[model samples]
Target: MFKLKRKIMSKLYTDIFDLATAKVYAVGRRSVWRDYFDLYFILKNNYIGLDESLLMTETRYGSVFSQKLFMEQLAYFGDIKDFSIEYGLGQKKIDLDEVKSYLLKVVKNYSQSHV
Candidate 1:
């Protein structure tokens, strides 16, 4: 009976650890949308004046879906910086007041239309 109990407890612990590890992995992973936004910002900055080849290297992970979303946002915002405003500026390396103003107008228009 004791041996059976020990085996059951061990299985339970193993299951719990598996769940915890999965959660940890999920938390550490960046969503594809976030990756697209990072790439967009990098491109929008003219690759920070870096060589185009280097910029291409940075965008190596971009998939078809990410590219499509990036272009859609570009069309909607008319500028990459303005689209970045919607994602919050915590990750942004530069601040452009004009972009922020434009983002405000876009958000206002969107809100009004949805109402």
Candidate 2:
């Protein structure tokens, strides 16, 4: 069972790395009672936060919104994957194609604004 799980995770990581618009920097596993993976990616100038950070479980279930924005507080924060895991909150599964589309849109918008 553990071997099968590892195989699935390897495939998922490869699929994420193959995305053209986003440059993946690191992929690592973290455990705090349960195991989860964190993928660090670079899209244009964004780093460590926003869409650049992704956290998901071994079964690949997590949030579509990687970051949280609070207008009243004028603050931004990383979405806690632990809550999602605990409460089964993120029903929408992670989709690589959708991620690619979103990253491409960000790149296009950034380029246009700067030029």
Candidate 3:
């Protein structure tokens, strides 16, 4: 009876999926993004989900924000920042204001929703 109870309880432990679920989110690099606002916009608005879809899996963990994931998240929100507003065009040089505006918006949104 004791052995049976122990086996049953142990079987209920949830490590495999629990760990994987816990590892889904990655922390953002605010300083780096703040310093390079334009680059940040390009990355956040265009690159978030692509990288996460590519990199995330049952056995993988990401320590920092991914290039693709960041952009994807940014694109989700359409703020059109300072750098981007001035230089917003397809395949052309990226705008600095656009990046700054987009980064601030995404980061703020992320913080509010996440909390």
Candidate 4:
């Protein structure tokens, strides 16, 4: 039972890490604004590095993950229009433009260093 419990706990931690990493990597690939919002907070909290997140995302998504498309998507956010905003619990509201600006800057910095 002890060994089984340990295995379960280890898997749980790995799953949690993978989920968080995937969320961070989902920023550019997903169309929903919440993806970007979640990434803003994830990055704000320094949960994971962009490259590490991408690697984990690749593990989770296999070849379906596209770095080229992800970079392209990160470079733009014109599709997300202004809309009603809501935050859960203690979270505070943030402007859509602010989120976009933050993400764009992140991508720009990442691009500069990676290139």
Backbone clash count, each prediction separately: 0, 0, 21, 0
For candidate 4, the TM-score is: 0.73
* Best-first order by TM-score: 4, 3, 1, 2
Off by over 4 Å in 1: 30-115
Quote each prediction's TM-score.
0.26, 0.25, 0.32, 0.73
Span of 10 residues, lowest total lDDT, candidate 1: 21-30
- Per residue, candidate 2 scores C-alpha lDDT tens digits across 6-107 of 999888756554431122211122222112212213333242332323332212324322222111111111332342233257644544444435544654
Return the lDDT, model 4, position 113: 92
Question: How many pairs of residues collide in model 2?
Answer: 0
Q: Of the pair 1 and 2, which is ahead by lDDT?
A: 1
lDDT of 4: 0.73
The better candidate by TM-score, 3 or 4, is 4
Off by over 4 Å in 2: 1-91
Per-residue CA lDDT of model 3 for 20-81, tens digit only, reads: 23323221223222224433533465533323332443235444535445435444433323
Q: Give the TM-score of candidate 1.
A: 0.26
lDDT of 1 by residue, 10-112 (tens): 9976654443333222222433323334333443444331133223323543442242232234234332332233545575454545444443454455456
After the best TM-score superposition of candidate 3, give how far the Cα of residue 6 lies from its true spot, in angstroms: 49
